[model samples]
Target: MRSGIVAIVGRPNVGKSSLLNALVGQKVSITAPKPQTTRHRIQGVLHGDNAQIVFVDTPGMHRAAKKALNKAMNDAASNSLHYVDLALFVIEAGRWTDEDEAVLERLKSVKSPVALVINKVDKFSDKNDLLPLMEKLAPLREWAFVMPLSALKGANVNVLAKQLMERMPEGPPLYPEGQVVGHDLSFTISEMVREKLMRSLAQELPYALTVETEAVEREGGLLKASAIIWVERDGQKKIVIGEDGAMLKRVGTAARRELEEMTGGKVFLKLWVRVKEGWTDDPKALSRFGYEGG
Candidate 1:
């Protein structure tokens, strides 16, 4: 059987997470239209009849502010390329920009083979519309493969999967058959809550907010979970709570619904919002939030 790690590297909102979900046929990672939605390296396992592909879904690569947290997130995306069997260099097929070329230039240092997987092909009106995109990428003649796919539509995903297998060496599965993800159960739950909040909240609020699963315990036939919503200012905390505690209640209900689905049991969820001034820039706060390698 063939087995190896495939790093999905690209800019934000390019359907990187959508591609991961499509490959695994499950929601193993959180997705958002917002940039830098992914702050951690989430490993999603794709199991075939004989082969297993471990997909490392990383945060988007971009120039960051001087903040340590931003630097760490950007570094994590690049560091993923250091020791991978193949790099699934994703790009949007509907558009071509200098940033795409810059991304290609930066990845040239990697010794492993690179597969240029052009995503969002469904946006093209016809095959002819894709010609320009292919033309722009013609400089990368040495790429292992230039593939077009629609992660949103699951078009040609199997083709990309087959190519990934060809790029990997024969080996045993990296994870067990039933194991499809690498995020801790608690961490996954927290991220789901964050995704819900991101969907419900306004701009800048989602980025300012951080979700943490504070307590999880088994209670007879149900699971008990408590989460903390960290904000940088008191006003933000009040805003998350809403009038008459309606917003917090909504967040709790949403999180519990997801937790029940994940654990296959009823969940009693509790959510609390706390203010931690400038937590994003605070070193101690960064560590607490799992932003390492700063």
Candidate 2:
């Protein structure tokens, strides 16, 4: 059987997480419209008929990684390129930025074959409009394969999967048949809470906040989990908690519903927002929050 690792690299908000989810037919990474929604190197396994593809979903690589958190995220994405069977360089169709150029320059050093995945093609009404962009990028490098598809609309996604499957080296499955995600239960639970907070809070709030699952246990038929939402300042904490604790309650409810659906069991989740005061820039705090390269 064909089995290998494929790293998805791209600039922030280019739909890299969406592409990984579409390829795996499940949500292995949380996605948001905001940049840097993904903060870790998450893996999703695709168990096909004759191949098993371990797709690594990485944080968006970008410039000006001044903070400890951003540096760690950039490191996580860049580190995934090494020793992989294939690398999928994902980008949004009809748009290219300086960050994309930066990622391409970084990919030049990657020994693994890199495939150009032009995602979000469904944004355009006419397919022919993509030709100019394709022609422009064709000479940049000798890419292994180039496929234009939409991760959100599922357009040409299967074709991309088939192409990736063809390139995987022959071997046994990397993960068990039914296992789709690489993270553990606590990580998954923490991410769910973070995702809810990311989607609900203000734009800058997400960068200053993170979720940590403190305790998880089974009480009869229910799964009980308690987590702390760490913020960098007292003002941020108030915003997260909201007036009379409305915001926190809303986030907890949304996260608990998703957790229940994911685990296929009832979930009782407790969330408490605490002030950590610039945790994003503190190495010790970053390490405590599970960020690598801290």
Top of the candidates by TM-score:
2
Model 2 / residue 107 / CA error / Å: 0.5
lDDT of 2: 0.94
Q: Give the TM-score of candidate 1.
A: 0.94
Q: Which portions of model 2 miss their true places by more than 4 Å?
A: none
Per-prediction count of colliding residue pairs? Answer: 0, 0
Q: Give the TM-score of each candidate.
A: 0.94, 0.98
Candidate 1, 104-192: lDDT as tens digits: 88788988888888899998879788888788786774788899999999999988887787777899999998888888777987898
What range of 10 consecutive residues in model 2 has the weakest lDDT sum? Answer: 285-294
